[model samples]
Target: MQIKLIAVGKTDDSSLKELISTYSKRLSHYCNFSFEIIPDLKKTKNMDESTQKGKEGELILKHVNTSDILMLLDEKGKSFTSEEFSEEIQKKLNTGMKQLIFVIGGPYGFSPEVYQRANQKIALSKMTFSHQMVRLFFTEQLYRAFTILKNEPYHHR
Candidate 1:
């Protein structure tokens, strides 16, 4: 199965970009991994939080295929240990899924419509993290998960 991470807004920090790139390159050895950025909305000076999210939601949905499994990185979602996460990844791969898409929403979070489209949700931590940081953290964890699956030295048990 292919894995894709879709996040809103551009990551401006060069350091973070480099780190994310590093993990992404490592991930390519195990599976087809993609990081897609939905550009931040412009002309939102008068738009409310809900309205902004709704617009972002529309764009987020556009990339999804009916057969793809959509997972949201949400604050209220279930949190799993690193080993458990690797197991979950294995389960998905076993299903022969075409694509497994995980979305990182904008500052205001996901819209009602986006939530409706999601197949499930997973939380990284109980503490809050910036959208940009989440991208880096998620990428690294995904890389680690693959390493664990392959019994590689990259990940220590």
Candidate 2:
């Protein structure tokens, strides 16, 4: 299955971008992986939070295909251990999923429409993290999950 990570905005920190790139490359060895950045909305100071989210949601939805299984990285979503995450990925592969899209929404979060279209939601941690930081964390976790699946000593019991 192909795994795509769609996130809003660009990463400004060179250090974080480098780290994200590193993990993304490692992840590619295990699957058809891609990380896409949807440019942040311009002149958002004038727009209300809801409107900004709605606009961003449109862009987010545009990237999604009906056949793709959409998973949102939401704070209130299900949390899993490394092993469980690997199992979840295995289940998707077993079911013959074509594309798995995990989205990280904009500053104010996802709109109602986006929520409705999502097949599942996953939470990386209870602690709050910057959207840009989350990109690195998720990619690293994905790489780790793949290593764990192959019993490569990347994850512990």
Candidate 3:
């Protein structure tokens, strides 16, 4: 199955971008992988947080498809260990789903509509993280999950 990661806004730190790219490349070997970035909304100074979140949610939803499974990366979502995460990936793979889409919303977080549409919600940790930083963290974890599934040494038990 193809796995796609969709994150809001660009990464300003070149180092983080490079690292995210590195893990994304490693993911290509195990599955059809792609990373997508939704540009940040412009001129948000006048808008309220809810409005900005709504606009960002629209852009995020535009990349999704009715047939695709949408997973939101949110703080209040399910938390799993490395081994358990691999099992989640295995469970998704077994479904024969065409694609599994994961989204990292903007700073204001996801809108109510977005949350309603999501099939699953997952959290990397209880601690808060910047949206840009989450991209790299999530990508590496994804790569690590694949390695664990393959019985590779990348993930030590």
lDDT of 3 at 79: 100
Worst 10 residues of 1 by lDDT: 148-157
In candidate 3, how many clashes are counted?
A: 0
Angstrom error of the Cα, residue 88, model 1: value is 0.7
Candidates' C-alpha lDDT:
0.95, 0.93, 0.94
Instruction: Pick the lDDT winner.
Output: 1
Evaluated at residue 139, the lDDT of candidate 1 is: 97
lDDT of 3 by residue, 96-149 (tens): 899999999999999998999999999999999988889999999999999999
lDDT tens per residue, model 1, 45-147: 9999999999999999999999999999999998999888899899989989899999999999999998999998999999999999999999999999999
User: RMSD in Å for candidate 3, one decimal?
Assistant: 1.0
Off by over 4 Å in 2: none
Instruction: Indicate the residue-level lDDT of 94 in model 2.
Output: 82
Error of 2 at 114 (Å): 0.6
Candidates sorted by lDDT, descending order? 1, 3, 2
